[model samples]
Target chain A: MTLEIVSPGLSTTIQDLGRPGYFHLGIPEGGAMDRLSLRAANLLVGNPEDAACLEAVFMGPEIRFGADMVVAVAGATMPMTLDGAAVDGWTSFEVKKGQTLKFGFLTEGARLYIAVAGGIDTPPDLGSRATYPIGALGGIEGRAVAAGDVLPVGQGTGKAGRTVAPELRRMPGRPAELRVLPGLYWHRITEAAQESFFADEWTVAAEADRMGYRFKGGRPLEFVEREQPFGAGADPSNIVDGCYSYGSIQVPGGTEPIVLHRDAVSGGGYFTLGAVISADMDLIGQLQPNTPVRFVRVDMEEALAARRDQVAMLDKIRGALA
Target chain B: MAEIQAPVPGTFYHRPAPDQDPYKAAGDAVAAGETIGLVEVMKTFIEVKAEAAGTFKGYVADNESPVTAGAVLAEIDA
Candidate 1:
């Protein structure tokens, strides 16, 4: 089966779980920014959680299915209509051949995930079908989906289709707190600065994008020295250059914190103050400009617990679909 | 000889404040770790420090313009 992209929205691309174990080479593990929602959509249609799906940002594309298939949409409650009738998210529905699917402006969050049964049949790069626009790798030509792009659908393995119960759909609202882990450079900032980062409410800056989300609030962070002290690698004296990883909170010149995301670069000179715990990165994606955000610190133990909880929830959903 | 660059992606500002004079003009002597420019990402303003003491040469990117990581902001004669 093939799906035709009529309107590809602001930024839409094929994404899977992500590409790991390549961070040392300055390559980011690009994947769905909101793994929770992606997995929900996939599971709703009886597909594996890691199956490649369309990651739509801001809005979604208009598409026409070439063959009958079970599909699910999740995350960022955008106004979506299938054949001019409203369709609920987190539930699987069969689309007839030639039926049109269209989406409208974002209602709550920044991105949405649309999963089709059997997954999208795209060539995988580095063992993943995720699209990393920067450095151009993976997905459909390593870029965002554009008008006229025809996405091939993989053949299903004959698994019985399943749908999500209404009670299982994600609640419509914004999260108030963002869980975080102190990063490598966390010690560089003063105690007061750390306190402010967690206590004061900050707003998402307009400068946000897939690369990173800049936050505006609290007092500027101050450092003991202007120059970064060397720990290892390039001479603490040599300047380092490259893109940064997703969810990394960077502090440059002792100032406001900027959280990097999926499309972010591999490395850079700015000190990464902290990282939004992996499980909480999706919470960052849903934040809109001017939305209040508070960073709540969590220890490694807590982070692992949160991850386990997330994994267990997804596995349970998948089992229900089986 | 050495060159100075913006350490991160942001909008380059020539002076520290809106009403202040430019930090250093072309051919001005500069010291290592001196603040030559500022890159404003979000509402945070970060001073870009020169890595090595040198004579200020010229800017590769214009002031008040957006730049990506590693984009050379200015050249210095070390």
Candidate 2:
């Protein structure tokens, strides 16, 4: 079956769980900003958790199904309509042959997922179908979906009408408390700056996209006074180019702090203060501009616990749906 | 009466920018797709447009107030 894109929303691209082993080769594991929702959507349609789905940003897309199919939408509280009538998201629903699906303005969250029961049949790059637009890797030729694009859909095995619990869905609001695991070059920053990093309410800047989120409204951080080592740039914020962990928060010129996300550069010269916990990285993506964020320091144990909780939550969703 | 609802949720601004005048006020005329305001989310200002042509009514949402998706933004008398 084919899904015809009528109006491609902002940055609508295909994504999945991403490739894990290729990071050492400088390939970013560019995938869904919200894995919980992506996996949930996939499970709703009886697709594998890593099944490729559409990642719609800011707005959603208008697609006309060429054949009957089941689909689910999760993440972001946008108005979903089938043939111009409203339909609830986060549930598996059926679409008749030649019927169109459209989305209203995004009310909450930054990215939303649209998962067809059979998964999106896109050419995989680096062992993944997730789109890394910067490097031109994976998903619809490594770019966002454009109008007039005809996407091939796989035959679905799941039945329609599978709905997730209301409480299970993520609701967007202010002041997300993201957990951070302080490490890497955390000691390079003065203690005062580290304190401020956790203490102040930082606003996500407009420059934020899939690559990273730049935080404003905080005290500009300062590096400890020291002579620059050879091969390290002259700027105090610069270090010898080192590998970056996913969700690494770095400061450039000691100005606004930026948290790298999926599709982020693998390594850079900027000194990273710490990495945000993997479980909370999706929350960073959901935050609206001007949304308040406070970084909470967590131990590795706490971080792992949080990840376990998320996994268990997903399992719970599968149980509920089953 | 035609009520215009917010398509997306964020902080609603009556003007395009802080220093600019609002697109419409009470008693102003508006056409469909006319930009009436902007919703600031993650620093992206998405234009809130007039859904249909009508005589503009004052906004139900306060200026610079946080709003959710599907919240009624303003009304219009066609």
Best by the TM-score measure: 2
Candidates' RMSD to native:
13.8, 3.2
lDDT of 2 by residue, A1-322 (tens): 8899998875689999988887788888889988889988999999988999999877788999989999899998788889988888888888898999988877678788999988999888878999987788887888889999999898889788898998777654578888999987888999999899999988777677888888888888878998898899999999998999899999898789899988788898999989999888878768766678888999999999999987788888989877
Docking class of 1: incorrect
Residue pairs in candidate 2 whose N, alpha carbon or C atoms collide under 3 angstroms = A105-B7, A106-B8, A107-B9, A288-B42, A289-B41, A289-B42, A289-B43
Q: Model 1, stretches more than 4 Å misplaced? A: A157-161, A165-175, A226-246, B1-78
lDDT of 2 by residue, B1-78 (tens): 988887665678898777889778999999988888887764578788877899998899999887766688888898
Interface RMSD of every predicted model, in angstroms: 10.6, 3.5
Proportion of true inter-chain contacts also present in candidate 1: 0.09
Cα lDDT for residue A107, model 1? 58
Tens digit per residue, CA lDDT, model 1, A104-154? 656566668899989998999999999988868888898888989999999
Off by over 4 Å in 2: A170-173, B1-49, B53-78
Provide the TM-score of the second chain in candidate 2.
0.93
